[model samples]
Target chain A: MPSSPSNQSYHHGSLRAALLSHAMELLDTKGIEGVSIRAVARLAGVAHSAPANHFPNKRSLMSALAARIFNQLENEVLAQMETTSGQRAERVMAFAEAVVAFALTYPHRYRLLWRRESLIDHDAELHSAMEAVYALLIGTIEGEDDEFTTSLETRAIAIWSMVHGYLIMRLDGNLMEKTDELTQAPRHRAIITALLEGIGGGPSGARRDC
Target chain B: MPSSPSNQSYHHGSLRAALLSHAMELLDTKGIEGVSIRAVARLAGVAHSAPANHFPNKRSLMSALAARIFNQLENEVLAQMETTSGQRAERVMAFAEAVVAFALTYPHRYRLLWRRESLIDHDAELHSAMEAVYALLIGTIEGEDDEFTTSLETRAIAIWSMVHGYLIMRLDGNLMEKTDELTQAPRHRAIITALLEGIGGGPSGARRDC
Candidate 1:
């Protein structure tokens, strides 16, 4: 997987990215406990101390990796928004679907993004990236309705929690075993729609009368 | 902590409980990685092999612990339901509050209860216990309303996802940092209320009109 650094020598700027990439691979296969600076350096085909130049400790490396995941998550959500054209509730469902898709695609990395210990020290960058995603959700919920009096931030948190929680439960197989169906996408969409409806809205624009 | 099995002899049933108690303490302080069958035996002052007799392996021990947590969660939710007298939405909010409180009180144990690997082997029992909790929530939502066409199961899942997701985010300090207020109870209540509202209901019993 190491591309020989392209120039046959690891550039200083690329070393950090290489270490992070290798560490993520280790995490996918061996989990968080399997990753270490030395292992990442070895996987990158660099000197043992090479990773130290970029990440002072294991925690820092994990933090950087988490930050990268958050950035990716933000980008993915924005990308989904760009391609989906619908009413506010439909658009929100699209965001939820994108999040579930991302988590299902990379379950380990998605879990790592929410690891409390790893993200504690990287709050500033991680929070900023996460906030961008939340902004999209909040804006969609707010939409063109200037009379909406409920706190948009609170709505965003609830929506994010519902969708994120569903993804986690799905990954853990909690949702699948309860139903006879082999697939949970339809159920998940229904749950999301119900939650949206509970918030005083719906896919059919029923809340406009309220 | 072992109490010498209380009869100066290691009874099989008591030994299992003692080991699980010690293991939970270890889980709370040192996390899941800190727990092991041997370590639990050592901490409980039992013979090293004592735990092996009851648990058979580390996964078995962890599975037992997870089952206990689910049972405890069910009890807590049931207790909340008992004392809470209100319309459907308020009662559901009470259940949500109880969950968040339990998770906040024992964050590590709460996380352990949902670990996919740990509970995979114990799915039948664990799912049964969790199903009881969901039944309570579904019953509350379905209360005296035969005309409610939405799936109670889907509503239950959405409510669970929102509340569980909020607790995880709160434990990670994601919710606290975004707000100036030190307390999250009110914010949590608000979020739950909004989600319920989105489902075409509210704390004021307005969904009856639907």
Candidate 2:
């Protein structure tokens, strides 16, 4: 009889990557709690023991997944910044658009990253990766010093808050009808303007007729 | 012989409240997935069947728990607002401080409220309670508005984003370290000032030297 694949010791060359891809799909369907080695292996069409060899336990799997997601986001932002040349406000907007697009495209993954309160602890790599993302944001804000304060950390927090909140609201369908009253580009610009100028500092950015 | 009273039906007169309370503690300790009606009943020192008489399912239990937390937050904010009277800027400062204080005091519960994306769709009562809290914030801003270009909903979103972002960063210990630079009163004032005036409109309320 021909050799059976199930009996083969080394079934696939990239079981780890396959497991993670299946895990992401499970997250989209069942959310964070739904992920497990057996579940992932089942989805990946592998024996149940296959994932145990890779992840061993749930915490290891979660940390690895979160690290991968943040790393991807970091690379995307860095690439966007490297190629873009514009005014400080323009770069800020481009960065914001890039972030929003990421969140929109992988809504479940973005939600999983923020859901790390339960999963993250003293892991230095995860901690530093999160901080690295924050630093990139602060770097983007460096260009806005002429228009705003140079406290990159504080301004970054303000911008992060606005963008994160907007993304969450949009994903939840809360921003649908109301945001239609104004074009998103101008609203985003006005918010970036507010972050740079303060609330009452700039020429009233609101349309007079609206 | 008489039946053992503890094991008998109706062992706890307030089994419903006890179950919810126990579930909240479990949520804090183990996050959402760790919470189960049977586990809550076990923690509450009641028969496992007792929780079913009240909640019937995990979804309903979670919904009830979220409602309780929201009600507590609503009461806290209203009580704090009642004690403060001032201009628009002062009122905004007071509100922000109350929000920060509340979130800091109950970090786990706060995360449960904010980080759980599925709650918005699963529970109508919970959703309405949340909207009511946002309305209170809108009323505070409306009291100070002279122009009213943006709708109350938009303004509420802006304010919530700022406070929510601040709380998230503060909890993660990602803020600048300059404790003595501004007293609580001034820090509160500065955030409100920046919100009202925009970045360059006036002093950011930060230490002028920085």
Candidate 3:
């Protein structure tokens, strides 16, 4: 029978993990274009049809990998929040720092997470995995708004957009590091503190065409 | 003579413009990958070797296109700043609004500007054109630090990073619009105001493990 000892292949669960591991390796080396079902199956040392058992198509495989990587990001955020000791703002900043670190470490994986067109993004597991990190951010900004009357969602968006934007700029090489002028902390940290305290300023003299 | 009317074809300057126009159309329809020396020349109705006179290769062509596009974005920003009336912060926000608008209108063109690897980014025209936008931002924030002690560069970076990040996230479908809980303003505007005013908040309880 196909179920016999030698015929069983690696356990069903582990095979899927193996496929994902191989897929991730390909993504790291070759970027999104390099990842495909047949390639992943080959990397895993299985028949090309074998991966179809877990992921019927390339999109499904990408979505699963995205879900796994997103979960890893969520775990990184959680771990940072857990160990960081400070005001909620500090923890929030830590969350951002953790993201920047993770992104810098795995630039390709991070980039793929945002290429929604390539993934079955609506897949339940992938959706929840992304929402988990987003929800954590919203939860942090929930009731702490003491100075500005901005909506909680707006506040969260502001922080996240800055964090995401800065990282992507760095990754794309559109932005580069300059020593922090306001504080001796990392440029990113200073920027985060600015996000917290606000970078209040305006023209001192007559407001002419800026 | 080689300079005769029939042999002259299109004038050199006009031909450059025409080729760029065709390349832009290709880029809009098919993205960065669809663009190449051979493809652009075909679209321009010139001989396949025609584009090489202006652009030595695809990289040079892409760089020229990026410079041209960046200059257009700069014009948009300047136009907004010229028309808007209010505090300098309002003018600054208008600058960001213009960028977001331009990006949404020609998402492909805007994306291409940041793909430095595919471009000769150090080319003088492209470098100066990109720096012009950055300089405008820094100049706006120059004397306006009436409140926060953050450096001018940091403040500019904060605003720019958020704008860039928010637009990209929106483009990639990582984030979407939700009604602003704080104001009737558009979600992006509300977030911009939050950036200006600071999203001041803290946990309502004692500082424990978050």
Candidate 4:
């Protein structure tokens, strides 16, 4: 076999993305504990020193990985929220769907993002990046005051906690095993509806229901 | 120092407690990854084979640890809930306090129990034991409702998810940073109040001042 390329052979422009891509792949196969800068460099077909140029340490690499994950999440949820204007029920459902969909497809990433708070002190920029994601959700629920109740902060926290909580429970399989009758979609819809109705008023006061 | 009696020569009850107590101490100091049967036995002044009789493998030992942790949590929460009679706000506040207290004081055990879902299929008894702890919370919440607006199944999933999510967020140090001004006490009260009022339309609605 031919000898592998040395540290000098690595291209600079794409090394960061390549490292993150390989790191996520390792996380998929071996969980978070398996991810390391050296391990990622090995998988990315680069020399060990190549990864060092992009990430000084594993923590820095992880912060970037987490930021990208949140960036993707923000885009997905923002897109879903765009589809449901003026309809409170639809808005809540879309927001909840965005959360559950992300959790189901990328359970590891979901867990990692939730754990970001533990690292806020370790990295200041990450706190703002994550806050941006939270702000997007809060904005979606902070729609203009109707003739009825109006408190954006309360509504935002209420909706966020409810949806976030449900996603965690479902991903952990707690909700799945505890309730046999309802699958994820229908249960999600019911929860979304109940929370909106409970917030704005019962069915009659809700902005949209179907 | 006096010569310590070896676990092999120790009485059965004392050895079992010794193993568990030593393991718990390790858990507090070093986290789950640091605690193992061998380490626990060593810390307990036992021979290598001493713990095998009490816990065949790591999984069983973890299960026993989780069960004992939840048993303590259940008793503490139930006692607090009992002290608060018919006042919904007081009852809810006590419940939230009990949860935060457990998580803050026993951060390791709280993480162990919440993260235990990852190991559900490892043992049947462990799974059922977790459900029973959840059932205690559901039963208490159901007791508060004069008439059910949401099904018991829905309520259980929703309530457990809210508290679990909150505890996870707090223990991971996420919510703590956000609520430094209010302290976790008021922030959790706000979340719990939103859940209660968000479920039913009444004077119980969360105060707009928040």
Candidate 5:
């Protein structure tokens, strides 16, 4: 019987995955500065040259990690969208909630995903994955209306900015102490719904002028 | 005649400010990691132990830097607010424009301002300076109406999140390429106005239901 990939011993095929996993662990504990080719190889219990064979350099290794993060984000958000059943606003909120949860749980990974230095080369695969997520958001917003007053791209950017900003602030504990209520999912849903409603795109029953 | 503090040479009284200025330069060029007590001292041409006298440790130095940044932000935003003349929405857009411009010009400093690790201690002065900025935002939002339906704090957070999110995305080049127009002040003003109007607060002529 063939051994499962997880159960298989380290080899060229599994070596890449093993190094990435170890790098992720290092990132969680020591942040971006802690991640190095040598450190990852050491953690993976591989020879010093093994990571180089797969990644070639520190930048390549970081790029791969960022790509993996984008892929994971896409999968997680898609899964949330799939299970979410409600009005367009509710579904979008659910998707956004999933994103916020992921960011808060893995703030380092999320930070690395957006770091300009790491993304200097404009990795095509990462760009595509991010675009897919944006498409998901745009589709969800447009799905709510037969006609949206704002351009699809504008709405997407605005909504993305709002949610992303909130998540970052929350993770950094920048929110006011009195806003502890916002930490709860129900309260969060209400805030997001209100924000969407304010924009005339949510379940608030208000229609924006086309 | 007593020498002015600004004219004072590097001595016990001025050593702290000198080290901080040098550290800011390092932060601008090399990011937070490049900032070290030794490097700052070397740049300032001060004794190696001078920074230790003022900061006691690296965290304290960073905390002081964060506080200084908050103070600068408050001053810049306030200056923009003072010079801006128009309706409530126009004034708010002006304030947001100042923030975005500042972030873009000094992306590294702006980034350091939000980093949680650099701000672990919950420094009282930093907290106060941040609150002052928030108060400025809230005042601008509330100034627009004697009878606003939304609570002041909620409106402030939503708007702050929107603008802050937009700035971060802009700096990271995360916004869609087609929206390059947003890099301009006029385009930014329009979008912020629309977002505020969406929330029933700006001059977009689209009042949301309270």
Candidate 6:
């Protein structure tokens, strides 16, 4: 119960940092089911009960870990947005690329973030981080000057779902990575344009300046 | 190793069929991990070696079960497509509705279909069923007459990814079910339309008749 002071390697905020670092390693190597408070503590070379102050149970530990991962994702998207030329379509492309890069780089972490069942009460910090990313993405679409039949939320959801599904498919080996030959663009760029320009002139294909 | 002749409850093709039925029960109630050769054998009240004639291991058992489930999903989609009005967009809507219904009704079964890692060599029957369903969806898009910057395959992938993403999010309870207030269409319908018409006229928003 009072092992914090006795531990020389872990003291103050350092212990929490050590625990989280070890927790991420476990998550990356063994997936979410392999992670536990005791396992993380053991990995960190601390007493099993030492993590109690930071994470009381496995669920809380997972919740905190997920929140931390989402924060990284949020920062990635924000950094991409900040560096973009700020055009609506350009920002959309940048946003999609940032998310795809994140998912590809840390596939397991990306998977853990969406698996709400494995975390605790849908942790508030995690929720906010996710919402912030969504808000950032939607902000780009909201800047469009023309009127459309669908709401901004619909447009946002459509893009998000498409990217999310496409990302998961590639990560799971259900789909392959490809590129557009004529335009010399990644398949994702083609896909995003396909949605932006409509397909085969079905209801919204006219490029008129209306 | 199986005493099939002596067991009064099992005779002829019934043992194989019985094993499959119990395997599905395990899949529905306990997910993919719950169903295995040993577990199905035990559940069917047969010797552990009883399933050896039909399935050599957990992978083969899951492969057969996945094939059967894909057959069911294929039939559901075919029936929906057949009943559609033969219009391109109408058939597209019908195809999307059928898949959404199937995923909703058998969420666990739907989940297993895409999870190739749990099955054996991506069983031939299962592969054919999936290809057939995909061809059916792509057929609708191939009927479009106007010139499109994106190839037919790109267009197909875009809609497919959007619908797939939407379905998974709803199933996982990550996204709430909502309807389009202006057109009184389900959010899925709106999403489909959003992709169809493009958004805010970034490149394809004009509804002009060309």
Clashes of each: 14, 12, 4, 0, 1, 0
> Taking the tens digit of each residue's C-alpha lDDT, what string does model 6 give over B1-210?
244433665543467778888999998898766777888888888888889887778777777788898788779988988887666667778878888889888887887776555677546776676667778778867855746667677777787788888877776655343323334437787788777777635544544221
Question: Which window of ten consecutive residues has the lowest lDDT sum in model 4 chain A?
Answer: A200-209
DockQ per candidate, 2 decimals: 0.40, 0.31, 0.33, 0.30, 0.31, 0.40
Q: What is the interface RMSD of candidate 6, in Å?
A: 6.6
Model 4 stretches astray by more than 4 angstroms: A1-13, A34-38, A46-53, A116-120, A146-151, A199-210, B1-16, B36-38, B46-57, B87-93, B117-122, B143-149, B199-209
Question: What TM-score between 0 and 1 does chain B of candidate 2 receive?
Answer: 0.77
For candidate 2, write residues A80-178 as lDDT tens digits.
877777766667777776777788788877776666553555456666777787778777756433333323444566677667766665666543335
TM-score of chain A of each: 0.82, 0.76, 0.81, 0.77, 0.78, 0.81
Best by TM-score: 1
List per-candidate RMSD values in Å: 4.9, 5.1, 6.5, 5.0, 5.2, 5.2
Residue range with the least summed lDDT across 10 consecutive positions in model 1 chain A: A201-210
Model 5 chain B is weakest, by summed lDDT over 10 consecutive residues, at B201-210
lDDT for B183 (candidate 3):
39
Candidate 1 regions with alpha-carbon error over 4 angstroms: A1-13, A29-38, A46-50, A146-149, A180-184, A199-210, B1-13, B47-50, B146-149, B180-183, B199-210
DockQ of candidate 3 is: 0.33
Q: What is residue A44's positional error in candidate 4, in angstroms?
A: 1.5
lDDT score for candidate 5 against the true structure: 0.70
Q: What is the Cα root-mean-square deviation between model 6 and the actual structure? A: 5.2
lDDT of 3 by residue, A132-152 (tens): 999988866665534454666
Leading candidate by lDDT: 3
- What level of docking quality does candidate 6 show? acceptable
Q: Provide all candidates' interface root-mean-square deviations.
A: 7.6, 4.5, 8.9, 5.7, 8.3, 6.6
* Lowest-sum lDDT 10-residue window in model 6 chain A: A176-185
